[model samples]
Target: MLINDLIILQRGADLTKIAEFKLNSFNSFFINFIALLIFSLGFALILSITGIEPWLAYIETTIYNGQILGLFATLLGVVILHELLHGLAYIIFGAKLKFGIKYLNIYTMDISGTFYTTFEMVVILLFPIFVLTGLLLISGILFPGLIYWMIIAILYNISGSFGDIFMLIIILFMGKNCKIKDEEYGFSIYT
Candidate 1:
């Protein structure tokens, strides 16, 4: 879906595109790989700090007896929930919400004309990472059997959020009070 479609759906203030960073297949892959690497390293550091043998848990693989299908279903549900959390954050910050899928990837946008503070936008972008990781970590601690799935979910969600993290880094350097319009592949920030 185009931004115009979102404008029509929201029927709210007009947003002018100030800057856009488009992500093609190669760039997206590279960014996601970097994100995965960083997140994994950070997680390993945390484990080490807590006196856990990171290498042992990291290398151990669990065999799925008859739960392969269930695992995939749960993964799909988690992916959808991740996008919904993005939309929820946008809504919480008083922005109109629109969701769409492009090239089999799902995305949510805040299309309102409200110019958000740098702190607000950063919180919106990082909200899913915080919420999802927190839940998965808690689940892993409470249910030993679900530890494998929890780790996978946390890693997948963090890696998938590469684009948001990239955008946040860019927005951090921009002036305060910049209006942001989220698109499927990227976002525009106007001063």
Candidate 2:
């Protein structure tokens, strides 16, 4: 059994198991769905309240003209970009990076035993959301033709990020100076 480096700690090691970030598939799905709903409602409200006619027109045109294939492609690209940002952050923080996909989940991780500081892990978690949102916004402005794709990417990116946001909340409560290892299921925090 080749467990990643952090797995060794759980298998039996010197470090105390401070916390286990157990993943719940149903919870993740539920939260992501709820987030999407809330965001959509809020965005609609803002557009209506603020009288953002341009945005309204763009969205109307997009909904009417967009194809299923384009939507899927844009969303898939956002997911790929999201994982790449995690990989980039991992490398920037001195971890050996590896990428993998299983079923619908695409991921980038440090395969070796190298664990990261809480701050480093936070950056790894959030880098994608911030960077991608910024890029999508800039692209939407610079190339109006991409507005349809950008809107889809933005919606997906924000909704997809709730998992990372949940982990961020967890990391905030973790013990100070703790080491974090990305695990298959979630995270293993060692103090």
Candidate 3:
């Protein structure tokens, strides 16, 4: 209903629907699994190149007790932070923002009345991944004691970004001045 309302309100004489996709459970799982595998391999390659063993980091962290709860809390915080980063990017680019959660999935959106260039939209979509990954890498390097947790957070965040990356790839191939209407489950693009 909300998506239909948005479609009615945003439709213009020249605007044409270029593409649409819904992120159902099956695709979401598949995409995220692939992304996680890629990110893990990449992270492992980085560690190997630097001669830094994650097992060493893990073993050291395991010596400290009660980190399970701390890790859980950190992951929860990271999910919230990831959505907030998306909202922030949308706002910075002058788009109206809305955020919501359904079941276990959390989403942040640019509601309406805003159009973005391909570059701007790509930045908005990928901003969280870039920021989180950079922070985690820097923190892990600076504070070796935190590397294990940081690595976990980085992988989790990357996996969570599957939907955004999917949308980004779609938007990249669309017209330069495409507009996006974000829904809780998916997005519709118009050009």
Candidate 4:
């Protein structure tokens, strides 16, 4: 396995470009930060309405030891697994992928730039949030001892997905005629 301090997934545009959104841009970064808080609030509402796990359970966990350390470890694992899930969805959609750490986290790129249709790209973006949240919920329910940590991991993973969520929002209006290429910083939409 190879790791780098930074991974450059950016490539020169080889197709007609409509718009390019960048993660490092001021507007996008502001939106991403706000999106994190929005996701947290939204998911919190979902959990409360569903009552899948009592809010108290997430708070008072005397059942587990070393939760502080364990939670950090779990979050890190979830982040990597989150990226892998994105890659998995891309592969399923017949896209060639490359993995990279734009700053300090994993993001997947379609190596060929124009491999994914709008719908497929949406699936790739949303896949991890749904799958990981479901898995975490199930594990939390089954292993009551882990509910506290599992819930935190779920929230972190979801909120951490601000970039994907933002891209998905933009892509929804882009229609199915466009192709998307993932970039180290953000994404490119091609007509």
Candidate 3 stretches with Cα past 4 Å from truth are 1-11, 39-64
Compose the digit string of candidate 3's lDDT tens values, residues 1-191. 68855765656445777887676777667776787787788678767876676566665666576566888887898899999999888889876777776545688877655556678878888999999889888989999978778887888888778778877888767766787666547776788
Query: In candidate 2, what are the lDDT values of residues 8-102, reduced to their tens digit?
Result: 65644756768877556675566667767866875676567657887768667767886656778888899899989888888897777777764
Q: lDDT of each structure? A: 0.72, 0.77, 0.77, 0.74
- Model 1 steric clash pairs: none
Give residue 72's lDDT in candidate 2 (0 to 100): 80
What tens-digit string does per-residue lDDT give for candidate 4 at 9-29?
A: 232344577877775657555
The candidates, ranked best first by TM-score, are 2, 3, 4, 1
Model 2 residue pairs with clashes: 5-113
Best of the two (1, 2) by TM-score: 2
Worst 10 residues of 3 by lDDT: 4-13
Report the lDDT tens digits of candidate 1 across residue range 1-191.
47855665454245454576666677667776787797788677657675565435534433325666666776787788888888888888877887776655577876554556677888898999899889889988999877867776777777777777887878766656666656556666765
Q: Compared to the true structure, candidate 2 yields what TM-score?
A: 0.78
- Cα error, residue 3 of model 2, in Å, equals 18
TM-score of each: 0.71, 0.78, 0.76, 0.74
